[model samples]
Target: MSEHSYIAGIPLVLGGNVFGWTAKGDGAFAVLDAFYEAGGRMIDTADVYSAWVPGHEGGESEAVIGEWMESRSVRNDMRIHTKTGMLGGAELYEPARVLHSLDASLERLRSDTIDLYYAHKDYPELEIGQIVEAFDGAVQSGKVIALGASNFDAARLGAALDAANATGATPFTALQNEYNLVNREAYGPDLQALAQSRGIAMLPFFGLASGYLTGKYRTEEDFAKSMRGGRAQQLAGGKGPQVLEVMDAVATETGASLSAIALAWLVRQPGIPAPIASARTVDQLNELLEFTQVELSDDQLARLTAAA
Candidate 1:
């Protein structure tokens, strides 16, 4: 349906991977409050979030979001987008097993239904039709409004769409991939074509390149700032710096934060209704909120695109 994507009209979807890890309790609540008051309506989380952290098995972010929505009573006002198939691999994608995980995610999210549920990643070893049927099963139960594919390449996502059509199953309406300025390979020309043709909106993750595009990690010496600083260094070695250089010039001209400029650039791209990014603090969220105000001209977008 809706040409604006299922979430419809949200400028940004707040990333929730850091909710129970780097941000928690009052700190996490503050950021959530800021985002909501600033008109942010969607949050992207997964069953496997925070599992990489020591002592965290999984579902930490979901639980934290659940607590926030319950305590704040804003569940109806927000759109929740979460994923599955990341932790259990091929076996979890079995139709019955995938539905089981959907129940668990719904419980942890403290919701009767999820606005959007994604397959997390493509399991190519399994049949593409099987994967489509598995997620479509959730839609059949009315627990999920729409299905999405995360980390899926062009060929596989296209195949899954075709399978859904053949089987009369609900096709994926949203695509979440590792798309950003530096990492352009994840959502390249082929992927872009599919999203446009199928009317699937790409809610690109890592929109800030894990903080590299934020202009915080400009040099090797600045790599000690956070956990993703090493990734920043890797991004810095390639097109990261060049993109940041262009972003810096634009920021100077418009008095906007690099985070805002980066997200602003992403929103202007084709098939991207909104970009998914995270902020660890209220101050950080305010910086990200600046994206709503920063509008790039055609020439500026071209320069950032050329740099990337």
Candidate 2:
């Protein structure tokens, strides 16, 4: 099996969770168009996206992306990274279930091949060898180019890697987890070190701390603006404001938006190449895109790291 890097030239993976949920139809298309026009190459989506909605049954985001790609004729120029094993409300990581979900994802994305396919989360109850073999089958079948593990702890990830090595199955090439300025415990030093040692690319989701790091959700009243405000509310009572203060200082020093500083800090981490974030509008996307141009100094990064 050949090892492949999932990231292209850009250091941002556009999150597709907003599509068909908060941003739909022309709005979703506009954001996607702006992202690609700004040199974004990868999009992160899952088959279970928008399932929490009242009338939705998931795959809505993938269908929107599929239609967008078909309409824009930009399939060849873009890298689509999607996840499975998190839907169907059934047993997770079953070999047959994994393949079945993949086929459904492929159908929704309107693509025969996926550049990168991720297991949405680790199922420790399942044998690592079984998971490895299931994902490896996709690679051998030319359905998925690379395999990734999301929301996996360091020890479990290491075990999965060992299982792959012993069985000669394709190993995970990327890791996706809840990593950001305010939330560091999940993907802390141990996990970062493991990823670096294993050469697994890190693409952290919730890179903006669910909008708390965006400087828009400062006071309790700010939570009233979005449906996901509860997440920001939880951060408000803790170190969220303190972390924002450090980000504010860095933003002032670099003239970058709070979103950019947050993402820039993520990119500077040891094994991270990009951070996954979503924008409901072109304006929000522009703010996030600024991170590509902003460079944080060692001191600024250190201060942010220490404050969080």
Candidate 3:
């Protein structure tokens, strides 16, 4: 793929899952502006974002992004990546549902075309050829510039690619999965190899392990710092602290923040063009932007990998 085909030059993709949820209204706007001003390009969101929240029917994040893009007049400069599927009562990957979901997402994003559209999860019950045909239909209609898959394993992704190739459909150009310094079981070597061989860009979410790698959740008291405290506590009980220690050393040596080191490690991995991260505040966004300035050494990378 060409550098401009996927999210190139930018080593980070700002996540929109926090928008209209933890970060509301002007807070979301400020964070978006800060990110763009810092040279960030892609913004990842979904149709079901914040739907679990009490009065939300989803599309909250996409609406915020749409408004921000219009008000800032940066719609042309931004690469909007949104997803379908995985919404409550609409998890199937059938053609009619896929097209309906894409139209709704387009309306919410205020864009005639989505730069990259993703299937949020794999529905094993659905036929791979049918799913490919549905997504390819969006591409042919100019509603989507590119296609992607998230939360899909190696076998399923391979099958989808095969189906697309055989049926003359547009194959998924990107893969988004849960991969971080501490959580590597889901996206292991096999998946990485398949994505690399197929030229699919890997943009892993939860790149900072839900803020655990930021070094703020060191102790029990630290867990109170955010709403993800319970998860942080659970991670701290495992190899989370060990990963933090190695990251600390790398940070001390490289003069980069823990978040930057964590993200830098991700961007350096095989087949990974960028990593997805979110900041509820402008300060946090600035910290994440620092990853571009950080370049880990071979020894440092090895030590960090071994530690993890």
Candidate 4:
């Protein structure tokens, strides 16, 4: 569709949430540099990113990316994607508020136009049309080139799309939901049906299951390896280990890292342009970039899917 041209045929979209949080200073720059050098263009981040960390009031990731782009002189060569409406209350979707949020994100990114912007999550208390109109206003003003819905349920996403069509406004061309080998609850049958019917490109987040699928968190002591280790504890106790076993076999057979296998699996799925992932180091980034080269066989893909 003409409306989806902006994000068509895209490669990996390097996530920036870890920039100001886990990957800082030159470490973050190294990862960004590795991604850019590898022909990666799109970078996904959020205004409220890293705010959960004490003393960080959001925009930290954007500032890191902005500084990197300026230092490397690659701002014009990249497609930047960021989100709004997560920090504020329900009224943040108001037209003026949406514009204000866009301006703030623009200032942080040191760019005039955001290639793609997202409503970080839906405010179900408000009307869908009102939210769509507010976001479309940003598009109308030439601020954001495209819009996407993140963390939206199937029913809500359908209504929002319908509302956009009803008003001839800018419809969401992409979706940012959590869909990985193990965590398929958010992008289940109903949401998949809507996405398939509407031809929405899925740019799924947490595609690595927050490092669980990397085969790094096997033992109980492995949980102490990183700041995000605690988050993967639940996955370790249940079906996560089972899924990791499959990924390990695939990795051994393919002579690739588990990280690469995980990402490659997502890239092979239908309707997914690319799965969003972050690398705290250039080594990890290189591993993920390998997904572009690796092609899972039909049996490998089936086993991976069934393991989940």
TM-score against native, each model: 0.97, 0.96, 0.96, 0.96
lDDT of 1: 0.89
Q: How far does residue 261 in candidate 2 sit from its true spot (Å)? A: 0.4
Q: Which stretches of candidate 2 lie over 4 Å from their true place?
A: 1-3, 88-90, 235-237
State each model's CA lDDT, in order: 0.89, 0.87, 0.87, 0.87
Q: Which stretches of candidate 3 lie over 4 Å from their true place?
A: 1-4, 89-91, 235-237
What lDDT, from 0 to 1, does candidate 3 have?
0.87
Give candidate 2's error at residue 50 in angstroms.
Answer: 1.0
Query: Candidate 1 vs candidate 4: which has greater TM-score?
Result: 1
Model 2, 1-308: lDDT tens per residue?
11355687578999999999999999999999999999998999999998999999999999999999989999888889999877753365767777788899899988888988998887877777777888888888878889999988998899889989998888998999988888887798898899889999888999997888899888667888779889877754588888888888888888899999999999989888888999999999999999989978989989999986
Prediction 3 TM-score vs. true:
0.96
**What range of 10 consecutive residues in model 3 has the weakest lDDT sum?**
1-10
Residue 146 lDDT in candidate 3 = 95
Quote the positional error of residue 202 for candidate 1 in Å. Answer: 0.2
Candidate 1 residue-wise lDDT, 236-276, digit = tens? 66677778888899999889999999899888777898999
- Model 3: per-residue Cα lDDT over 108-148, one tens digit each: 88889899999898877777777788889889887889999
Clashing pairs in 1: none
